[model samples]
Target chain A: MAENRLDIRYVAHLARLALTPDEETKLSAQLGNILGYIEKLKQPDVAGVEPTAHAVPLINVTRPDAVGVSLSQEEALRNAPASASGLFIVPKIVE
Target chain B: MLHRLTISDLAAKLARREVSAREIMQSCLDQIARVDGRIHAFISHDAEDALAQADAADRELTRGVAGKPLLGIPIALKDVLAVKNQPLHCGSKILDGFISPYDATVVEKLRAAGAIVFGRLNMDEFAMGSSTENSAFGPTRNPWDIERIPGGSSGGSAAAVAADECIASLGSDTGGSIRQPAALCGVVGLKPTYGRVSRYGLVAFASSLDQIGPLAKTVSDAATLLGAMSGHDPRDSTSVPQPVPDYGAALTGIKGIKIGLPAEYMIGGLDPEAKAAVDTAVKKLAGLGAEIVDISLPHTDYAVATYYIIATAEASANLARFDGVRYGARVEGADLAEMYCGTRGAGFGPEVKRRIILGTYVLSSGYYDAYYLRAQKVRTLIRNDFLQAFETVDAIVTPTAPTAAFRIGEKSADPLQMYLSDIFTISCNLAGICGISIPCGFTSAPRLPIGLQLLGKPFGEESILKIAAAFEQDTAWHGQKPPL
Candidate 1:
């Protein structure tokens, strides 16, 4: 449809999502259809236009540094799937 | 019929001692029990807690608490907004069994207003999709016609309001999520200007576009909810600092207001019945002594494409926080990378996965300029188009969706077709303006509700609400309930 079929495995890997074979096949086709629709923008001339990240222009918003109520460690990790010793747990990364 | 009372009616009755908060709560609970079996609008509701809150509201009412506007009204929260101690699943398997440790800012505001917040309604995962069909939990059937879909990802919110499961509900709109479903289900849905309401607790879908607003049975009811929920929150920097007006007071006849009809919104392929309804609405506006000017938003066609790029890119970044370590359901593996991959692989639904991949692809090296940046630039042009049109018109009018609610699974197979379902509503989000969808008319064959969307200038909700209220006052659409 476009230049090249999306490297579904590559993009999924970059997104840190593990997809099964069936999902990859189904998604590739769906994405291809969406991208083709998006290609319609080629007809518009958007040169020299500022990219809008938000609806309104935002400046660097800063607040005065002050101490305030902070969540207790237990409250912070209340929803953690695995935790030990007042901290969130994850699979061992270092051997 | 306590469940059928408008928020204002309920508040007035509670103040006059004509009804107690507990009585109203019981009535809603009973209604839910009788109807929810077929509607499934709710994911989970704590009846005991809801009643407890109602009891507390009664105590406050007896104690002569001066003025708590929504002191005892039952309001449903779309699953994405985190309510303290409530399971915030966001209609996704990824976050199942997770309880919110704290209330989102909106939840805090609602509690302060004395509203009895209850029930987490169903939605498309992360507020994606045009229909509730994208929910990992089964789709929420339309209350209007059970065989048809409740437009989504705020489908459940609209259904609950239409079916009187809750007096009014809060829903988040990223791109027609609030209004489309409200339109299809025959209720009033408002997507406030992007920053008018705080986004402190709304689960991020597309950060720039996502906004939290109200869905209610009437324009005034929607106004009541908005007044209570609006204001600047330090928790959300984007929350506008301007004083929140008494939106309810703003409701009045549009005696001589200027309205615009954007020609671009009325192109061919629009459903003929919907077109007729909007045309009639324009005539009615003219009859009300309102000036109707023909306007143009030339860049309308590029909105869907621009939205997909910007929303997907932002969504990819926001959803990255869902890795297994912090919270949510997890899958274990030998290593950290494997754990992340395994959990995400299993957790996210197909539609979610497709979006993440598309987003990632657009933001990837070498493609950033070609896709993401171009879309943003085009987004500015679209915004400019609206700003120019607003110079003469107080607000613009259009169909909320191209058609009435279609049958469930109708567009599920074609994602592109589903994306186009929001064609008329997407530009408002891109421009960061406010909009509302009110039941304007209906289609006869299967008898589905149609909506008239009013687009307002940034923070110009009062203008649209007044126009909508006036239109609503003269019309009978807002009063028509689903046959259910």
Candidate 2:
């Protein structure tokens, strides 16, 4: 069995996910199993191996800085959960 | 019956002026209405809009505009892609009610080729699960056996094609999402070499791993779709600037090509029937005058482990944009933090939440080096293993999945077991190469379809397509349809 190193509640908090009691219990067990499986990564001798972020090498992919057709404000706001006068509405942040 | 025709067949008929695009669209809509209740291949489709597009295609055909390959074809898209004025749900509740204002690059290309695109097909939430059971809407059942899963997260794409609900469809493969489902549902699916198809409007699951490809009735059909879809898009910088090759012209034969059978893939856990099918496929290729060489991808065992860490870590960062403030569903709470937590807690399904948490755990400050960084380094080893094997062989052959489609609920309870469902197909994505799954054979009594996988080097899609087309030509497996 793989050792349980995952702190479910803490991780959930970091991910901005509020978990129910039932979900907390289930996720704790399932993620433990997955982490145990992931422990296999330690076995590979990856000493001095360069980490590959992208499979195909991409460097300095720049295009001409010119204006192009852009989405209208109405179109951008069309799908927002709450919008008023072209601005998306979010829960209050200031106390 | 027109809906049952492959893209190539439909194209030939349309060119001969024997059929109109509207008729083809009607035929597909009829099929979807007929079998979709059982297969659940589509989340939703706009019949009126599809027919309108088809009518326009007919008008274009009347003008004698020839040479467009996908012209008059009715294609569906997995729900993960953004289609203009269409709902863009990644089979998750978080994206409910969200409609894209613009088409994805692949969708634009398909439109340019004159395809009548409609339907938001089902998939695993955020392209996360091996079985479509994780979809927030519902699971897409296999056409072969309604009780079993259509391998995911491209389940709906593969299932729709198998049931003749669409001429063909586009699917995004992050792990085995495209190939595994194609194997289970008995269709042709290809994951183009990474960056071969631009990911401009694909809802990001794992940015580095996500790729858009095709699922179709035959290898030639897949080749047609890939040709229409492949190109460099200035919008997606990761897209390769290499000129697109005419893949159809490369389907001559594999007379002198050397195909490799990796020893690591024939593991003990592989279903005996699947092994037999692949063994026979190798022999058939050998008989076709292709050399069969034994090869080893030594780091194969670590693939699933490497994939889980890197994919989930990337997903954690990518999916962070789904806060309730911007678009889609929202849940109210007291403050900004509470709203974010509450919305995510309510919106995401079990699998999505589990992965997000797992991803967050790996990328957290203290554990970053131990988990995410190590996994990335190990990924280098996995990629090297394939590069080393490709040195002596032009392509590699294996079973697309370890077994045929299992029951819908069979592995859903155990996330680890579900993760293992992708063991055979995940490494291809990790290696950033092209691969295809074609129907090879079927299991007896309560029969299910099995698939033969062909892997090609980066940008070597033509070689694998040639091999797949040849194998498909000499065999009757691709001709068999489900009892549906």
lDDT of each: 0.92, 0.92
Quick one: best lDDT, which candidate? 2
For candidate 1, lDDT tens digit of each residue in B1-484?
Answer: 8998899899999999999999999998998998888988998899999999999999999998977889999999999998878899898999978988878888888889999999999999989998999888889989878999999999999999999999999999999999999999999999999888888878999999999999999999999889989998887888778789999899988988999999999988799999999899889988987899999999999999999999999999999999998999898998887889999999999889989999999998878888899899999999999999999999999999999999999999999999999999999999999999999999998889999999999999999999999999889998888887
For candidate 1, state the interface root-mean-square deviation in angstroms to 1 decimal.
1.7
- Residue ranges of candidate 1 with Cα displaced over 4 Å: A1-4
lDDT of 2: 0.92
List the TM-score for candidate 1's chain B: 0.99
Q: Model 2's CAPRI class?
A: medium
- The alpha-carbon deviation from the true structure for residue A24 of candidate 1, after best TM-score superposition, in angstroms, is 0.7
- TM per candidate comes to 0.99, 0.99
Which segments of model 2 are wrong by more than 4 Å?
Answer: A1-3
